[model samples]
Target chain A: MNPCNHHSVSIKEMQKLCVSLVPIFNHLQPTEMEKIVHATRSASYQRGEQIYGAGDTSAQLFIVHRGLVKIFRLSESGREQLIRLLEPGDFMGELALFSGSPFDHFAVAMEQTELCVMTREDLNAFIEQHPKISLRIMEEFSRRLERAEKLISCLTSEATEQRIAAYLVELADEHAANSFTLPMSKKDIASYLGTTPETVSRKLAEFQENGWIEQSGQRNITLLDRYALQNL
Target chain B: MNPCNHHSVSIKEMQKLCVSLVPIFNHLQPTEMEKIVHATRSASYQRGEQIYGAGDTSAQLFIVHRGLVKIFRLSESGREQLIRLLEPGDFMGELALFSGSPFDHFAVAMEQTELCVMTREDLNAFIEQHPKISLRIMEEFSRRLERAEKLISCLTSEATEQRIAAYLVELADEHAANSFTLPMSKKDIASYLGTTPETVSRKLAEFQENGWIEQSGQRNITLLDRYALQNL
Candidate 1:
């Protein structure tokens, strides 16, 4: 797919559509929405491109307009920790936008991606005019915090296999299917689960051997025994 | 210290003072703060009292007027996972306040604690009247998300000793002193650091042995070699 394929849609229409896709804007007035649409810019990124990095001042919030993005941090040993894999309609860099601080992590395109971007100043001005947006932003932040707390618990206490199973279950539930293709590579999954790829591979093979799951290809996984997987 | 010693300060005065301590309320006009102050109520709890629990419907936001609170979750085996140790001026239950959902964790008073509480309905009404508070809330949440992300990295990758060292550095910085009394017990500290109390005890002893820190009695700790602790 051409990274520049976003040219097919008029930038105005694309921005409107992207902004509409965000739940925070769902309650916004048409005029308010239009202001956001006007402020938003669309950008395309090739796979493996760094959209933003740690220490960079976050001037804008980016919504995954199309394709995928990975939010992560580099550890002292230079190992990457995958914070999350964001899909289309998911937004990032709100921390910087809200606090006017530099980003603490890095974001990279996992595939040829298109992003809807709006400057912090523009968004803040809009929020000032429509303070209700702050409420929505708070709600979104609350949801993210709850998720992060849960992730912390899992990372600190859960076993590697249990964490992997929990992640798979989450993916299946999120995709609304018993089978789905992994959005990124197993290496990324390993990083996200705080285990090495070898452990992830061995764990998956063990699950397959135990008839807990079926791996069709490198990325395709079917939850044949989700209940048992949960018990693991 | 008597938990009920808050009696010296009139409830009305305490309420206004509590409202003022919240940074989000700093920008509010006196009349606005008055509304919050009028709606706020004070509650006291003995150490080990459960403030709120997982699955409880969150009906209010709590500000620690005095003493400490532990926000945590429980594993299947009933082991606690400390999410945060909130001190005076820190707050919790905002997730329920913003999202109107059940709490995903539990909160307990770590000591004789006094909390300033405002019901969700009252707080939401105040927010509507002064929506700019939401921006501050968003900024606070943004700060929390950043901390949570760092915690995820530490929980997932950092060794117990390293995590302990990092946490001590954070405490020293937060208290603005090299030596301070621990707000929570060593067991709670172990839970927060994702280790056993035995491990925590052993680590502290090791730190003392290495002349990296000095412990007085059980809780007071003085960082003798903060730089060396950082390198650990």
Candidate 2:
């Protein structure tokens, strides 16, 4: 996949695409979005391609234009923990722009993915010219911090079963339905939930036994009793 | 204690004070710092004062001008976890600024403290007017996020003993000395380390017994064997 072809689209069409997909960009004027769109360069990565590794220079901020990405770190024991999953419109590397530090986590393309990349210098310049955009970026960073805090709390306090249940609830809420397909494999989900695949499998079986959820296929999960699952 | 001494200080004085304290402000021209300092209002809090509670609307950004403050959250069982401690020149209330939501943690004065506060509206206006300042603010937020992530990783992976050792090492590093007084009490340390007071007491005693550290008093600790502690 090549992102250069995607960037060949008309600036107006790009602005429309950005506004339609990115919530923060939605409030921006078309002219402002056009400037941003023009400044951003698009790139594509194959599945398992390393978008950036831990300790890479924090030069640019990346927005997933399409496909999935996993941001994670490896423990001393070499176990991978997926800290976050990025879908289309989700932004990564903003933290690096602010800190001036190298990337702390490895970001890998979970699938062939398109990314809109903007250098920190250009983005900072744009933000300097448009303070409102800075405010939006700040808001986005704040939300991400809150979510990260919640994840930390869950990882520290919740049991494996509860973690799995919470993950399901979160997926359901984000997807806006009781039934949804898993974006990542079981192993990925297990790592994300801070447990093993066996534990995740057992928990899902328990949920099914309790009539809280129904597993139709490897990737498909249907919440039969959301309230019951919530209690868990 | 009330902060309304109403002793008006010149912007020049404010700039000088800020320059000596915050490294981020050190790079700014006197004129820039003067504008920022003039915008900030000074306030004081008595020891144990609730500067802000979790869920309180975030109206201002606070920079600790003097003394210590603790940021924390209470678990469902009423167990408090000290997320981080702030010293002079450190900033807080940023999480609220970006989220446009009530604070997620409670901030309390650990000692009689002075703070320089700028309303969120004023800060936003300042950032809009000076994009470079926005970049600095983003840098601060990024540093915070990095620290939070490291803390989370330690909490998830390290044992209680390892966590305590790590905390001591961190304290030593930050204070730039092997010997330092703990700003918070043993109970507070226990909460911060996600352990019990008894556990903290035992661990400290063990460290002392093993000649890794020495206790001069209840709060004063000296690292006697840095290598031993680091290896542990």
Candidate 3:
């Protein structure tokens, strides 16, 4: 499955779509955004495609324009830990943009996905020519760093249940609704939460039994009582 | 006792001294480096002086022009963990600069010290005007991030004794010249290693008994057998 084919959008349409979708480009003058949009190459990956893996040379920064991408690492025992999920408008590979080292994790397509790719060197050149754009990029980097630190702090300090609740609330916020499809499978969610799939299943069942949430299927989850869920 | 006073240098000269000492500034063009030197302020701190504490709003990026500084944090029980020690060219405050958060850890003067301080906002503005400068700064941040990720991996995978040995080798690589004094006390080292002071003492004794290392007084450690130490 290819997102480009599924969406049936032409390259020109995709370029326009890219400019409208990414907030980072919104701050730029239309001319500058057009230059970037013209430079960006759109690519599609099928579900489970390895977009890039750990130790891959840091070459391109990727912005997800459609579908989902999971950034993760494999433990020695072959257990996967998802560090972050990239959605539409979300960028990955900034770490590579700054560092010349190989990537530390793998980014896999969680669904048929469309991405706009830009080389780090070209991006740096663009930034050098546009100080205001550079500042905006720095601001974006700062926000990501803060989020990573907060996640680290939570991982070190919060209980498993609290972390799960926090994850659900975060998912809800991202989707901007009381209900949405789980973007990844339970196993992936477990890895992201640093727990077992069984634990995630058990917790979801408990939340349902407690009337905090309702599940219509394996993927569909609705916060039946958000206030109660929050308190939990 | 203040290092600046001990050296009989004026504040302006002290700041000039740091401009030449720090490697991160070495890449700057001579005129730009001179501008930075002129803008920086020099300050002195006595041993045990708190340069900045965890949770304090970070205002300045600090470079240790002379003497030593220790970046550390306190555990829940008030135990101090020395995270990193700064030598002449070393700097701190990048985390706060990029994250816009309070200092995540405290920096204390390990000895009477002279420091070069620049306002974070001023530095950010300077970087905005000079994207090349920003690139260099990002390079520095990348190095720190690499070190941090490596430390995290070691903590998660290595045994306690292996960690101690690895830490000693790291210190030796950075500071020791055949022999060098431990910058912080055993208690601080223990906390940094996530162990007790008694355990640190015991481990040192064990290393000495095993002919892996030799200790002279409580401060100087000599790696008698580097291969054996590495194997451990």
Query: What is the iRMS for every candidate structure?
Result: 1.5, 2.3, 4.2
- Candidate 3 lDDT by residue in tens digits, B155-227: 4345568778887887788774546677678887776665678988888899999988889987998877777
Model 2 CA deviation exceeding 4 Å by range: A1-22, A25-34, A158-162, A181-183, A207-215, A219-232, B1-38, B207-211, B224-232
Model 2 lDDT at residue A191: 79
Candidate 2 residue-wise lDDT, B82-101, digit = tens: 77789887888776766667
All predictions: root-mean-square deviation over Cα? 3.9, 3.7, 6.1
Task: Give each model's whole-structure lDDT.
Answer: 0.80, 0.77, 0.70
Q: Point out the worst 10-residue segment of candidate 3 chain A by lDDT.
A: A1-10
1 or 2, greater by TM-score: 1
lDDT of 1 by residue, B102-199 (tens): 88788888898888777777776776777667667777787888999998888777788999988888899989999988878898888877788999
Give me the overall lDDT of model 2: 0.77
Candidate 1 clashing pairs, residues 3+ apart or interchain: none
Q: Supply DockQ values for each candidate.
A: 0.63, 0.41, 0.21
Q: lDDT tens digits, residues A1-232, model 2?
A: 2335476888876765564246655556666777787778777799999888888876788888788999888776677877778888788887776666778789999898878888887787787677777777666766777777776666655567777898899999989999999888898888776678898898999999999999998989999998887666
